[model samples]
Target: MTKVVLTVDDSRTMRDMLRLALAEASFEVVQAVDGVHGLEVLSQTEPDVIITDINMPNMDGFGFIEAVRRDERRRGTPILVLTTESDAAKKQRARAAGATGWIVKPFDPAKLVDAVRRVAA
Candidate 1:
């Protein structure tokens, strides 16, 4: 089955890049503008994996991950934090909030696809 991935980011360019990369890899892509929008998207679709940016308006990735974790149906879903922040503290914080993995921004397309495949359920 083709995996569906939900990507949440405030940057339109980033969202477009991700959509292109994942779609080229044969994965179905869904997008949201920010964390709040991400939750709204999640309500409408069950994605195999979720990739989110750390910094966003309205709600950040940590808050997004926490919110997802709070929902029993989504608690076990794998979430990958894709951000420009490479800080160890931020990574730890994301892990605490229930993210399955981390990918630094300006990510390589192949590696990003690999990460998604590795974590997808």
Candidate 2:
């Protein structure tokens, strides 16, 4: 079965890049503009993996991950934080908030696909 991935980011360019990469890898892609929209989309779809940006307008990735972890149904779903920030403290924080992995911005298509495959349930 084709894996489903939800990507949440504030940048249209990022979203488009992600969609192209994942789609080319044969994964179904769902997109949201920010954490708020991510949650809204999450309620409607059961994605195999979720990739989110750390900085967003409403509810950053940390908050989104925390909220997802709070839900029993989504507790086991793997969330990958993809952002420009490479701070170790922020990475630790993301892990605490329930992120499965971290990927920096300007991600390589192959690596992104690999990470999704490795984490997707």
Candidate 3:
């Protein structure tokens, strides 16, 4: 099966950047505007992995991961948080919320691809 990836962020440019990078690595990208919408997408799309931004309207990354972990079908899905904040506390919160890994933004295209490949596999 073709591996699918969910990219959740409020910014269209960030989603585009992720699409370009992950597509080069042979994964299909599905974009979502926020955590609430991300969950809706997950129901229909069933991505192999999820990459989400922490601060978003409607719902944030922490809420998204919590919801994902609560659902048995999505409990094991790999969730990688890509964000601008580098605060240790935020990272700890994400780790506690069940995030598989993290990538700090101003996203390095190379690191983004490598991180996705590493976690999604």
Candidate 4:
């Protein structure tokens, strides 16, 4: 089965890059502009895994993760925080918000794919 991955980022370039990488890995990719859009997309698609950027316009990754976890059906969905921020405090915050994993930006496609496979397994 083709695993679906939802990627949320404010950068168009990053979103395009992610789509290319995930698609090359044979994963079905769904995208959103930011955390708010991410939630909207989530309403329609139960993706196997979710990758989101921390800083966004309407809502941030932490808020998005918390909202997702609030939904009983999506509480277990693996959420990977993909962002440029390497702050330990932010990582902890994301973890507390229910993120399953973290990946720094300018991510290695192979490692990102591996992380997704591991978590989505």
Candidate 5:
């Protein structure tokens, strides 16, 4: 089955890039503008994986991960943090909140897709 992927980011460009990359990898892509929007989208679709940015308005990635982990249905879903932030503290925090993996922004499309495949598999 083709995997469904939810990408949450405030930047239109980032979301577009992610859409293209994931779509090319044969994954169906769902987009959200921020963490709040992400959760709303999550309620409507059962995505196999979630890719999120750390610095979105309304709710940041850490909070988003925590919220997803709290939800019983989505708690096991793999969440990959895609952001420009490379701070070790932030990465640690995201992991603490239940992120499955982290990818630096300006990501390599193939690597991103591979990471998704590994986690979603």
Candidate 6:
């Protein structure tokens, strides 16, 4: 089965970038504007992986991760954090919140694809 991936970010450009990369990597893409919208999208479609931004308007990445972990259906889904923040503390918090991995912003598309492939597998 083809892997489906959810890319959640407030920025259209970021979502588009991830879409292009994942598409080339042969994964189906689903987009969401923020964490709230992402959760709604998740309810309708179960993606193999979720790539989300840390800071957003309605709900932040941390909150989203917490929610996903709490949801029985989404608990095992691999969630990768895509953010500009490189602080170790922030990474630690994200890890504690159950993020599968962290991808720093201005990411290399190839690396991103590989990471997603690895996590989704």
The sequence of per-residue lDDT tens digits that candidate 1 reaches over residues 11-87 is 99999999999999999999999999999999999999999999999999999999999999998899999999999
Residues 1-121 of candidate 2 have per-residue lDDT tens digits of 9899999999999999999999999999999999999999999999999999999998999999999999999999999999999999999999999999999988999999999999984
Give lDDT tens digits, candidate 4, residues 1-121: 9999999999999999999999999999999998899999999998999999999999989999999999999989999999999999999999999999999999999999999999999
- Model 1: CA > 4 A from native: none
Q: Looking at model 5, report the run of 10 residues with the lowest lDDT sum.
A: 56-65
Question: Residue 67 deviation, candidate 3, in Å?
Answer: 0.7
TM-score of each: 0.98, 0.98, 0.96, 0.99, 0.99, 0.98
Q: Could you tell me which residue pairs clash in candidate 3? A: none
lDDT digits (tens) for residues 1-121 of candidate 6: 9999999999999999999999998899999999999999988998999999999999999999999999998888999999999999999999999999999999999999999989888
Q: What are the clashing pairs of model 1? A: none
Which residue window of length 10 is worst by lDDT in model 1?
112-121
Candidate 4, overall lDDT? 0.96
Residue 88 of candidate 3: its Cα lDDT? 97
- Per-residue alpha-carbon lDDT of candidate 3 for residues 29-106, written as tens digits (9 for 90 to 100): 899999999999988998989999999999999999999899998888999999999999999999999999989889
lDDT of 2 at 92: 99
Tens-digit lDDT track for model 5 on 1-121?
Answer: 9999999999999999999999999999999999999999999999999999999899999999999999999889999999999999999999999999999989999999999999999
lDDT of 4 at 79: 97
